[model samples]
Target chain A: MKLEKGVLLTCDPAVKQILLMLNNRQPFILQDLDEFHVVIKAELEAWVRSQLETELEKNTYNLE
Target chain B: MAMQKGASSSTSVKTAQHSLLPFLQTQSQQSLTRLYQRPSSCLSIFRLLDPLSRQLILNLLWLESPVPLSVMTAWVTTEGTRAFDDAVSILTKLHILPNPSVKLSLSPTFKASMRQAIIGGGTTASFGVPADAENKKPPSPANLDAYALERWETILHYMVSSGRGQRPREPSRGVIKLLTDSGLMSGSEAAPQITSAGFQFLLQTPHEQLWQLLLRYLVMAEERGIDLIEVLSFLFMLSTMEFGWDYSTSSLSPTQEVLMEDLRDYGLVWQRKAKSKRFSPTRLATTLTSSLPSLPTSSSSSTNTAAVASGTGATSEGFIILETNYRVYAYTNNPLQTAVLHLFVNMKSRFPNLVIGMITRDSVRRALANGITADQIISYLAAYAHPQMRKFNPLIPVTVQDQIRLWELERERVKSDSGYLYQDFQSLGDYTTLVDYARQMGILLWESPAKRCFFIREDGHNVMKQFIERRKVSGGG
Candidate 1:
C-alpha cells in the first residue's frame, strides 16, 4: 500500500545490468523492480537516459 | 513503404480540410448556430464534411419533416454504419444536427441557410456581392495567382530563412504577429526564429499551411473583439468566390473590413489600391475549402513570371533525386526550397538551377534534435522526388528511408513513465487481486507477480487505495 513517485524505466535485461552498474556510481535508481525494469528518480530521467545511451554506445559496433 | 506513403498523404489531405472542424467544435453551440446562419458558411462546412455526411445532408435537405433514425440507419450498408455513426456524431457536435434521438433532422438555421446556398435564392447575399461593372478592370487570373504565390511564399521564405541566419525580407507586421502567436516562430518580431513547429509547417502543402494560419487568425480575431461568426462567414464566402472577379467592398461589415486588410497581407485577396471599392479573391482564397492545390502548378503554368522569377516553378512538381548513398540533388534555385533542404541535408554545392547535398546521420540527428521528425523529412523528400524516381515502386530508396528511421529510433531508446510502484502486498492473493483491479482500470503500467509488486499509473493510485480499503472492510486482505 506504500506509495512513491518516480519514473519507471523498462528495457532489456542486459541494459538493466548496465543501469545497475551506473546506479552504484551516481545513485539515481530508486528501486530495482526486476531484471528488466527499474525505478529511477523522476527528475533524473533525461540524465539517466543519456548515460545509458553513451554506455551502450561503447558496446555497439559502428560502421561510421 | 508505398502503401504507407499513400495512406499518410491521403489522411494529410483530409486533415487539411477538417482542421477547421476541430476549431469549430470547440466554439459554443450558440456561436455555431450563428455561424450556420450564413449560406456561405453552411456550404463551406458542408464541403468540409466527409462524403457520407455530405450525402446525409443532401438527402435531408428537401425533407419537410424529420425522418426516423431507424429509416436513415436502414439506408446504410453494414460496412457503412461506422462512417454513418461518425457522420452523425460530427453533425451533432457541430450543431448541424441538433439531436441524435429517434428523429433525425438538420438544425433549422443550418437547413435554411444550406438550402439557400444550394438552391440559389437568398437576400442575405451570404456569397460575396459582385461589384458594379462600370469601369471594370479586374486583375487577370494569372496575375492573381502570381500575386498570391508571391505573398504566400514571402511568409514561408521568412520562416525558412529565420533559422539559417540569413535575412530575407520580413513579412508584414500582422504576418509576423500571426507567426509568433501561432508558436511557429519565437522571440521578438525583429529577430524571430523559426521553431520546430515552424520547420514542420514548412513541410506541409500550401493548402494545409494556409488553413493553419487562418485558424490561428480566427483566434486572434476573437481576441481583438471581432465577431467570430462574421469572420468565419467571410472566409467561407471567400472560398466560394470566383477567382479574377472583383467583389464589392460595400457589402463588408466594419469587422470584415479590418479582416480584409489582414487577409490581403496573406494574399487571400487583392485590391487595386488600399481604398479600392472592389477586391478580387486570389487562387489561394478561392481554393480554401477544396482539396485542390492552392497555388498553380508551376509546371503547367511556367509562364507565371513571379513563379519563374522566384524560381518557384519547381514547387509542385517532382524535382528531387535521392540516391541510395544518401546523396540528394534538388533541381531548384528557390532560396526557400534550398533552405528547407538545408534542414536535413548537408549541402555540398549550389548551382543556379540545382543544389547537391547528402543526408548524413549527423544532419538527420540535428533535425531530430530540432523536433523535426524522421517521417516529415522522409515524406518531404518523397513528395518532391524526381519524376524518374517516381517510376520505382517505392520512391526515395528503401535503404535511405529505413536508415533515417533507425537514426530516429537511436535517439529514442529508453521508454519511461511516471507512476507508483506497489510492493509488500500482504499475500499472493492480495497482489493478484490488486493487479487484476489495476488491469481492469486500464492504469496498470508494469507488474511483477513473483516479487509481490506492481506499478499503476499515477492517476490510479487513489482509486486503488479506495479499492483496497473496501476489500479490507470486507475481510479479503
Candidate 2:
C-alpha cells in the first residue's frame, strides 16, 4: 500500500515569502530541505534574522 | 417520541412517524435545523420518502415515549410488514432512535412541536388563508400565463445583465436586496459577477431553482417577524391556485401583502397597481413543486417569458451528445447555464444555439476553488444533458465521469469522517443481530459479516444502544 503524506499548514506568514523561492531551480535556500514547506531559505533566513536582531525584533518574532 | 398507533393507521406510518417525529422535534427547538440536511439544500429526499411513512412519524412524535417496533409492526397488519421494516431501517440509519433496548421514547420537545404541526388547529393560523379580493373577474389561463412569464423573465434578465441594458421596473427594492443577500448574485455589486453557487443555481431545473430562491425569501420573511406557517402554507396553496384566475387581495393579512410584493419579483403573481385588488399567479407560482421535465414545455406557462425562457430555458427536452473523449456538447445559450458549465468545463467554442466544453483538470480545480462541489457539477450536467445524452449506453461515457471524480479526488488528497466502531461483541449471535439491524437501517459504513463486526455513523448511536439492550433482553448469547 502506498500511503500519501500531507502537511496541513494552519498559520505562519514566513512560509508565504519563501514560496517565491520556487522561481529558482538551484542554489535554492529552501528547496533541498525535503520538508513539505519552508519558512525561508538559509540565505533569506540569515539576511532577515541579522537585519532584525534587536530585543524588540525578537519580541516581534514571538508575536508573529 | 412514539404515540400509540391506532388501528386505523398503517404500521409503516406508525413506525416512520414514531421514529422521525422525535428526531425532527428534537432538532426543531435548536433553531429548526433539518437534522443533517444543510440549511440551504431542499428536503426533496425526505419528500421522496413514502408520505405514509412521514405521516406515521409525525403522528407519533408528540407521544411521550418511543413507539415499540413490535407494536408498530402489529399496526401495519400483514401487508405492511416489509414497509414497516424499511421505514425502521431508514430511521435507525438517520440516527433518530435512542438506544435500541427494544423500547423507550422520543425527545420531549420533538414530540410536542411535531404534534402541533401535524394536528393543525392552532390559533397561530400558520397555513395562510388566501386574502379575498374584491375584483371577481376570472381571467383565462392564457392571459395569466403570458403575464407571469413576462414578469419573471424581466427580473431574471435584470440579474443576468446587471444593469448593462435598459433597467426594467421590478416588484420592489426588498426583492432585489434579498437576491443579493442570499449570494444568488449581489444585485447591488457594481458589475455583479455570478458566484459559482449562483451558476449552479442557474443550471437547476426550473422548479427546484424556484423553490431554492423562494425558500430563501421565506426564511428572510420569518426573520422579520412574519409567521412561517402562514407564509409556507400560502406558498403551498399557491401550487394549488388556478393559473389564470384573478383573486381578491382585500382579505390578506399584512404579512401576506408583503409576500405578494416580493412574489412579483420572482414572477409568481402580477398586479396592475401596487395595491391592486386583483392579482393572478403566474406559471412560476403555480408550478412551484412541478416536476422539472414537465414545466418548461407545458404550453400552459410559456407565455411572454418565452424569449428568455425559450433562448435558454427550453420547454422541450434537450439534445446533448457525450463523446468517448469526455467532451460535452449542449444545445443552449442561456447565460445562466453557460456560467454553470464554465464551473467544470474549459469551454473550447460556442455556436449560435450550442455551447461546447471539455471537462478538464484545471477547469474542475478552478470550480472547486470557487466553492462549487464536484457532486453539484455532475448532477447539474446530468440534469440538463441533451435528451440524446441520456440515450448513451451509460448516459455519459463512464471514463469521463470517473475521470471527473478522480480529478476532484486528487485535489483533496486527505479526507476525514467521524464515526463509531463496535468491537468485542460477547457472542457472534448477539453481535450479528445488532450488525444486521444496523445495516438494515442503512447506517452501517463497513461490516465484516464473517467476523461479526461493523462500523456506523454517529447518528446511529441511538439505534446501537437500543440494539444492544434488546440483545440483553432476548438472550442472544
Candidate 3:
C-alpha cells in the first residue's frame, strides 16, 4: 500500500463509482453474464418470461 | 506512578480534556485493541465520517502523483478551506496520510477502501448481492413496509413489555429473545423490561436505529466470523437500488442471499417466497445508500416543505417539536417511535397525528438508568428535532436541554474516560508546545498549566517524538 512520495492520479467520480462497483463485485463472473450486453440479455429474459406466461394462460383459458 | 502530585502552584485546567469524540475514528476510539473486540465491518472507516467529509477525502485520495495541499484546496475553493484542512488533519491524525508534505493524500488503506468502495470491487465484498429465487410474484411495497415495521416494532414491543409495562398484544417469542440477546432488554423480571440502552435506541433516527441493531448484529455475527464488509456493502447496494426494480438473484453469493433474507425480515427487501431469487428494495433499503434521512412518507406526507422541491432531500426529516416550556410534541404515527419517545417523556395525551409530552428530570433520569448516556439522548433529540426546531442552531431549547445534562451529571458526578496519561515534563515550554499541538490535532485531553503536564486522549509517543525531532532540526525556539 505504499505510494510514491508525491503525485496522485485522479479518477472521475462517475468512473470511480463504476470501479468501486466492479472492485466489490465478485471476482468470478458468470461466463454468460459478464458483459453489459449479457446483463441486457438477461433483462430480456424477464420480458420473455412475462410474455410466455401470458400466452400459456390464454391457451389454458381456451382449453378450459 | 506518573502523577506529578505535589507542585508549588498547580493550576489544573480541563483545557485538554477530550472525551471520545462521539464520532468514531477519532484515534482514541480507533485502536488495534478494539479491532478484534468488534467485527471488521465496524472498521469501515468511512462510517465514522459523515458523507460530506468522506467526499472531501475521496476527491483527494488518488493523486497517483503527489499534489500540493494548495492544488487540492483550489478544487473545493477557499470557502471550504476549513473543511479541507479539517479533512486533511483528520486523515493525518488517523495516520491515513503517510506524510503531510505541502500536499496531502489518503493513507494506502484508505485509498484502497475508497477505490473499491467507489469502484465497487474489494476483497471485502461490503455491498450486498441480490438473492437467487424460484419463479414467484413480486412483493408489494406496502406489504414490505408493513413487514419491516412489524418486525422492528416486535423488537421494540419486547423492550417495552417489562412486567411493569403493558403487553401490546403478543410479540413473537423469537422477537423477545432477539431483544434480550441484543441487550436491549432482559428476562430478569418474569417478563423483560426496556434497558436504558433500549430506551435510548428507541429515540434515535431510523438510520441510527438501523445502525444500532446492525452493530448489535455485527457483534453477534462476529462469533460466526461473518464478514462485516460484505454485510455492509450489501446494505449499501440495497439503498441505491430502485424501489420497484427487480434484481436477478442468480448472480448473488450464498452469503449475500442469506443476508437478503435476514434483511427481508426487517422490510429492507421483499421476495415472493423463500424460494424466490429476486428481491425488491423497500424505502428503508433505498435510504441506506446515504446516511441522510430519506423520509419514507413522501408516499403520503408530500406536502412537507422540505420534501416538496427537494424530492426526498430531507430524507432525514426529524418529526420532533419541543416547545420552550419543555413540552415535547412529535408528529409520528409509528407506534414503536411513540414508545421510544415515551421513554423520556411524561406523556400527556396522544392526538391522531401527534403525541404530546414534556421532558422532566425524572423522565430523563429514568432513561439514563436504563443504560443510555446523556449524549446519546441529546444527539437523538437533536438529530430528529422537528424541521421547525432544526431551523435554530443546535435545535432543542436550552433550558430544557441544561436540565437533561444536569440530570445525567447528577447520576455520574465525574466525567469518565479511558486514555493515556502523560506527566513530568522537563519544562513548561516543552509541555506547552506539545499541549498546543495535541489540541490543534484535536487529541489533547487534560492539562495542568502549573504542573507542566498535559494528556492526550491518544498516545503521543510517535507524534511527540516526531515533534521533538522537528524542533531539534529547526532549532528549538
- The top-ranked prediction according to TM-score is 1
Winner of 1 and 2 under TM-score: 1
Ranking by TM-score: 1, 2, 3
**DockQ of structure 1:** 0.70
Model 3 CAPRI rating: incorrect
What TM-score does structure 2 among the candidates reach? Answer: 0.54
Model 2 chain B poorest 10 in a row by lDDT: B36-45
lDDT values of the candidates?
A: 0.86, 0.54, 0.56
Native contacts recovered by candidate 1, as a share?
0.72
Off by over 4 Å in 1: A1-4, A53-64, B1-17, B28-30, B133-136, B297-306, B309-316, B424-430, B471-477
lDDT of 2 by residue, B22-43 (tens): 4233333234422222211112
lDDT of 3 by residue, B347-453 (tens): 88898778899887667777877777766666667667777886785366666666777777655421223244455677777777878887887766555676455
1 or 3, which is superior by DockQ?
Answer: 1
Give the proportion of true interface contacts each model preserves, from 0 to 1: 0.72, 0.00, 0.00
Candidate by candidate, in order, the iRMS in Å equals 1.2, 13.7, 22.0
List ranges where model 3 is wrong by over 4 Å: A1-64, B1-146, B169-178, B188-191, B227-229, B294-300, B303-333, B350-365, B371-399, B402-477
By lDDT rank, best first, the candidates go 1, 3, 2
What's the TM-score of each model vs. the native?
0.89, 0.54, 0.52
